[model samples]
Target: PARFEEGDTLVSWLAEIVGFSPSDTRLAREVPFMQDTSTGRPAGKIDLVVARVADTGLQWYGLEIQAVYFSGRGMQSEYEALQNDVDPYPPFPGAVRRPDWRSSSAKRLMPQLQIKVPTLRRWGSKLAVAVDGPFFESMGGPSSNPSRDLNDGDIIWMVPVLLPKERGGFLLSRGHWEVLTLEESSRKLLAAETVSRNAFEQTLLEKLKPLVRPTE
Candidate 1:
């Protein structure tokens, strides 16, 4: 997995899922929340914000995209610590290491559900997460119980598949987009368990192998 250099790639992919035309979508990058007096800056900037029409009506959503690959000091240092066999949990006082892709994705997502999603809902918008299929699969493969509550509102998950490209490259396209309410996602998350890096790697390889050219 590689880091998406351009945010538009993700935005376009999401737009395809939501059926947002060029005129309907607006890219609000680095949207400021509120100013932090201590830091003298905005609290934080959202990665992306998309405004479009839902079945109910026109709505805005905070779109968060998470990738397996990362770069630079923060992730690099964490990776190094993990390689050194540092315990992720405290009480043993081991160094903080990077988490597995599934855990990392969860770490990034939980807060959005707990904080950002609710806040955005209050502001008359919603939160939608676009994650790779592997990560989604790691999150317990969606909830099966149909009687679950939908009180907290719907949480849309746009999962794109990796398609075999005719050329040497691979394309992430043509996959399932699921809409899970907050309760449903929470249930799925609760049932989810951490999978090993090797397992995930193997699964991804199998899925992407069709795109690879046969060696002569």
Candidate 2:
């Protein structure tokens, strides 16, 4: 068995576990090499991309996997904000507001990612960051920093996969993010996906209990 560093493999594995095809499950390295239109230049390494459906062309729903854990301190607060509202960030500098999800990522570093399906588009582009440890220490989000405005476009949604539950289920202060146990929410997903080490996944499923923090 191999030790995996990122979720790109896991998700791809999941897709395959559930029957996604070779044509559909493209590894980031396999996607056509295009200079990022946003930068008008090539970035060193891109992560993952998947065709929207059975026959969509190169335009894909991109996927980037991160192995960061949100520390317990402010997890619930962050989770609450995401699960509460679906508005854009307030207009720039002095609007003192949040922009809606679409436009937020539309005009910046990531720009609008062309999702494969128009309907699933509402769920916004799927950016899954699977983690094995704590991500931040405080409950206040990046937006709370007065000097900075955290734009929604940077990334609108998060799919957190808890890899290390024994450390503490995304430990957080009482008022921050809400952590959903992976064992409970993802039982079907785990069962459906053939993770190489079934026994270990089962063990962790019981021990760690991963969570999803759905934003509002």
Candidate 3:
């Protein structure tokens, strides 16, 4: 996750799925777009672009992948605990930790979409996004983003079902697909629900107590 192996794995699979022979297919990584007005340099890069040499010309789709990131204690203790376990399957999570959905979705992934998707849309190329099940579910994608058999969306989401291999490990099987416009995707990324006025004031007052510091 730190080195973004997940992104690389998705890119490999995507190039294969482009369904062209190795000779005909070209893979572009860190493809730059969205030029900075002042610097006149590309401000962002699409994760990967899979291009195929067709009879007429080159055809490609932009790929962006978001993997779940965990926030909390390091996994070192968890690994140390697993070493002492006798069971075939060691108990997970010796420490308290959880997937940091808010940070990953709102802070990390949202900016990527906002930067890249619109430009791709303008260029008449669809943006294909690969996100894990938990990531998609966190966004309430099934309810908010419509599922379509037809390929109509400017941004296409490919959510995978992690199927455990017979031996060990897992395979990312294509499980779900959804399509959304740039606007819809933007709204979904802004997952913060509004707080009530009373709730807001109560939280505000609680924090303010520390700052007051016993007024003379």
Best by lDDT: 3
TM-score of 2: 0.28
Over the stretch 1-216, how does candidate 1's per-residue lDDT look in tens digits? 343424366677666555678777777876886578998788866777777765777756677776664322355555565677755442332345443654555565665576666666677665667777777787766545432222345676766666667875566664656677676676665556679999999998888756578889
Model 3 weakest 10-residue run by lDDT: 1-10
Across 5-27, the per-residue lDDT of candidate 3 in tens digits comes to 44355555555554556677677
**Alpha carbon lDDT of each predicted model:** 0.63, 0.35, 0.74
What TM-score goes with each of the models? Answer: 0.60, 0.28, 0.74
How well does candidate 3 score on lDDT at residue 96? Answer: 78
Query: What's the distance in Å from true for residue 14, model 3?
Result: 5.1
lDDT of 2 at 11: 48
How do the residues 137-179 of candidate 2 rate in per-residue lDDT, one tens digit apiece? 2111223322211122322223333344574443211122222
Inter-residue clash pairs, candidate 3: none
Weakest lDDT window of 10 consecutive positions for candidate 2: 172-181
Q: Residue 33 error for model 3, in Å?
A: 3.1
Cα deviation of 103, candidate 1, in Å:
3.0
Best model number under TM-score: 3
Clashing pairs in 1: none
